[model samples]
Target chain A: MNQNKNALLLLTGISLFMAACGTSKTGLITIQEQGSFAVGGKVIASPGTFDPYKPTPAGQTFHGDHAYVFYQIPPKARKYPLVMWHGIGQFSKTWETTPDGREGYQNIFLRRGFGVYVLDQPRRGNAGRSTAAGTINPTPDEQQWFGTFRVGIWPNYFEGVQFARDTATLNQYFRSMVPNVGPIDIGVTTDAAAALFQKIGPGVLVTHSHSGGMGWLTAIKNQNVKGIVAYEPGSGFLFPEGEVPAPIEMAGGQMAAVGVPMSQFMQLTKIPIIIYYGDFIPEKPSDNPGTDGWRARMVMARLWRDAVNRHGGDVTVVHLPEVGLKGNTHFPFSDLNNLQVADLMSKFLKDKKLD
Target chain B: MNQNKNALLLLTGISLFMAACGTSKTGLITIQEQGSFAVGGKVIASPGTFDPYKPTPAGQTFHGDHAYVFYQIPPKARKYPLVMWHGIGQFSKTWETTPDGREGYQNIFLRRGFGVYVLDQPRRGNAGRSTAAGTINPTPDEQQWFGTFRVGIWPNYFEGVQFARDTATLNQYFRSMVPNVGPIDIGVTTDAAAALFQKIGPGVLVTHSHSGGMGWLTAIKNQNVKGIVAYEPGSGFLFPEGEVPAPIEMAGGQMAAVGVPMSQFMQLTKIPIIIYYGDFIPEKPSDNPGTDGWRARMVMARLWRDAVNRHGGDVTVVHLPEVGLKGNTHFPFSDLNNLQVADLMSKFLKDKKLD
Candidate 1:
């Protein structure tokens, strides 16, 4: 309250004062309450070897993944829960709270009348890694995001970039980021997310950025993934150079680095698919400029969508701006417009009858 | 700077310090230079009647609109200047500097290699009204905007809406607002904007909200209007009861006190149109919800786009979120992602070869 008051007092014009009309708490559920509604959380563990770099005295190589899943059960919840998958350099906490310190989408959806489940991928966030298999997984840094997720254009943010400028918001955003362990551990992450989805019963997959690739594989492997909303999935589905029905390869492919047993994109056709890309990216410049970064992701998404559709599957490649949203980063759920995006997702699920 | 430092000091956990790695200035162009460009401004005044409500001793009943236009003259300027039109409750200042204190689109475009022109609509902002036509405009107050602009559902913004919660941002936004004088003298407003376009030479129209109607009308009336980028145009264009090719109606139409005499919709098809809406609108709800506010705006934009396309016109409707932007407010240009959006507009203009 004091902070707000101080800010208000500092405001010189445009009437920073509000009547404190106080937002209505009349919803079926308020975000403040954790008990009245059904809430459950647990660490889904799996066995693995310890760090080879840090040798144990007893040669203790055995370890396990401590990925967490915290869910909020909405009243008369929909048949399928909403499994939210975070992106690279982030985890389930990404959906819990934003940098600006506002309520995350998990609670917003619960209020909007839908059950939501958030996942912490292995080796990220609250999730633990088996060993310091350093070389196997390349930890990502912040600079990569400026170009990849598009927090700003290359060279610098000041040069016409889109990241939030407020010091507070930027801080929150950076703080929320955890060092991302690359797709090298595709199996553990996919298995962890997949297991959570199954354990929670039938559910829809809501994947963001890097998790988008993982989510796709998990959805393919799990029959319970009623539908999929891949929001800016950065994983490029390697298209067969010449043919449409040729061997389709996904970064999160089942046999990818696992030595065996992988999920196939063909099986994904059983469920509805909607891929969302936020504003200004994957844009088609009239000059027919070369595709890369965001444009490439868009290309991959379109190809994957086309492939699925050609195979008699349901897929919708939604360029978000067409639906009316702009100035979003790779992390839309953590954006100021979080609720709006969540509302749209709910609408999509409702449309797919996945609810 | 002090406020920034204070905020940083207050911020806990997150490291707020930066290496000053000032964002890259190596854009297609840089926004920092002032000396290299020639800046000029002029007030275009036109005659009007005095307000009967507030009598003046000078018998100055005959008044005029002091519409101002600021032009940034860039070397090797593009074939067409970029004319920016502001929405209701705003003026040419809308393009000058956003509420968030960052540079607005005008500068962004100017830096992106385009001559930019902005207009102060008649009876709004710096453009003053002559007579108190008492109820001519009904001069809508703050409450009307809350629901109308989707700032929050009626009654109050305190409710669960998508408005930025921070007072500072809100203050800047509200401070930036100009009390709308309604569309009482839309002809004069459109004429003012149109005349400026002619004086400035050929240019693409970038209209926001209320100005969208004016931009459309001006484009139709002026041969110089090459194309249009209508961002979140909320004004509904009432299609003739049953006629497809009938004269269309626009909010910026002449003598629209209570009924018709509006322009035809077919004229709009002559030029390229791209309508953009920010996130969480034009949504298809599970509840089979009624349309109003942003939803209505979406319907209007779509109707206008479809009607134009039906007439063989080039048109595109962009829902920002689908393109990767989220958490945007009605005033996206004023939101945290303004530059991102400005960049997109610049890209569009570049693609159109307007710049």
Candidate 2:
């Protein structure tokens, strides 16, 4: 390989890379209005705020940790509000545009006639920035990020070969990674979801990976919620195949917090539930579950589905590989096949008469 | 681009392509007595040779279709053989090496400790040339091949954006395509399959797409068929959701060639049945079915699944997209996700105690 040839190869690779990108400025659906708003936060005093000697008072303080929700309503929407809760380390941006730069689920959902509400959950992304200092942060390492999501086990790029087949795509995928501080504050998330439902009225809930449990929590909070579609939610299924899943986490109103089993959360059984697990989940030793987290979640889901259905709750538990769909990561909605997965979820919602 | 730059780019592309290839001659699994042998052919009388001016009377001739099979018995193999039957237009080669030059299912099965038998069914691939001519001839065009196989619907490469996202890989896929000129003669295929089982002894039948129906026919042919994992089997699911499927085709001298409704598939109940349909199948309208053929097949599958389950048949019907695995074409086996899917299939067989 000569210098001239190498230069041309670089140019060629650059050209190919550039070709993968496209503008998301417009699509078949037009947004009636799109804007951001804030809700729910604790007041914390800052050291100084335009006061040289006198710091801000305790009674009148700055609002921090409030979730910032960005919403886009389609002019010709048929379905009510469809709130999207992202996974860990992700925010509203996850649903706005993909790594490949195409219109993300927010737009896709709107185009398909669902009013989209993308939530910036607490302690992550947009919401984390507004929090008071001292977040229990960890190093924002790509390897850790990939592992936590059960993306794959890899000492290097050679492993999980199917997940990220090419180096070019891998580069782009890493660019989309973000950092999260401490553990998720379930109370804050539940409140955010509740406030959104209160403001927009509940319709359907679409939660992905880490946010899967959020759908359940939010549904418990809002009575207006019609149905839920959890895409590999952080929510755990039950243990031992047919047993009831552990109770949903309940925040104390003003006292001790209590756990509420899904069955006791009577509203859950009223609506249809569909839980989807992507392909290549480690059923055997070869598959990666990061720390057996994903496998546990899947087992929990299976148990949940059985419990729910047995209790007259409409539930569909899907393991992607069982259906012959492989190579799907935790984030199926953002994969090369995102649109297809969305379509499948949309159908489930529609079939349940949620839409 | 200038001529100098263009020349460099071409050279660069060639070098990059050459880099992707590696010797398949060696891998984790070692080949054991791998070669092709013919089965079933009719003996006919022909004009003799050695006399230039006058033809000699009645010499021997062969008339039967040749069945070429390549077998590799593993060192520590399972109790029975694992036979693969390809769909239309494919042969044993479909299971030998993938389009991308990776290990194919036959080798994968062998690696997993199973004695593998790959069949080149009559009127397809290597078996096509061996058949006495004038069989139901049909042109195997690339255009039809791409479409019928559900690769994508493209009048040209410019359309169906998802179909050819990576032109490099798509080109590699096309290189693996082989031509088969003709409609399959069911009698010949059934005979060939029966002959194979007779020699190898009945085991597990792993059939893909068009040959899915063959699994059923073969199960009818050999009493030793322990189980079946139909990867989009050609046998259509029935009509109106409740109708019985059409009768299985039978060769002459088979006393009972009657069509059995799923309800009467008592044999199916004894063995596990797994049907896999890949992603992006249009229950709606955006996906491709190549003149709706794929969709029709899927519909038939759904009906078949429902009836089988109703009749106490141990059937698992999977529509890939439904489980959040998307963007799979008819050949998930050759997709970037092939190995993962194989892993899932292997697990299924093991679960059923077939392996």
Clashing pairs in model 2? A212-A233, A237-A300, A237-A301, A238-A300, B41-B64, B42-B64, B212-B233, B237-B300, B237-B301
What is the per-residue lDDT of model 2 for residues B1-355, given as tens digits with 9 covering 90 to 100?
Answer: 6999999999988654433221122322322222234444333335443221121232322233545464656444688778888876555545755555455676567667688887767544334333333222112234445555666544343233224456444433443332332346766777778777786776888888768876776676676788888887655232232354554322111111225554335566667888888764556332233525455566667667776677676788877667655666777665556777787788888888887
Which CAPRI quality tier does the interface of model 2 achieve? incorrect
Off by over 4 Å in 2: A1-28, A44-59, A129-133, A136-140, A148-150, A155-168, A181-183, A236-264, A285-291, B1-355
Clashes of 2: 9
Instruction: Give the TM-score, chain B only, in order for the candidates.
Output: 0.70, 0.75
Which whole-number lDDT from 0 to 100 does residue A242 have in model 2? 32
C-alpha lDDT values of all predictions = 0.55, 0.58
What lDDT would candidate 2 get against the real structure? 0.58
Classify candidate 1 by CAPRI docking class: incorrect
Model 2 TM-score, 2 decimals: 0.42
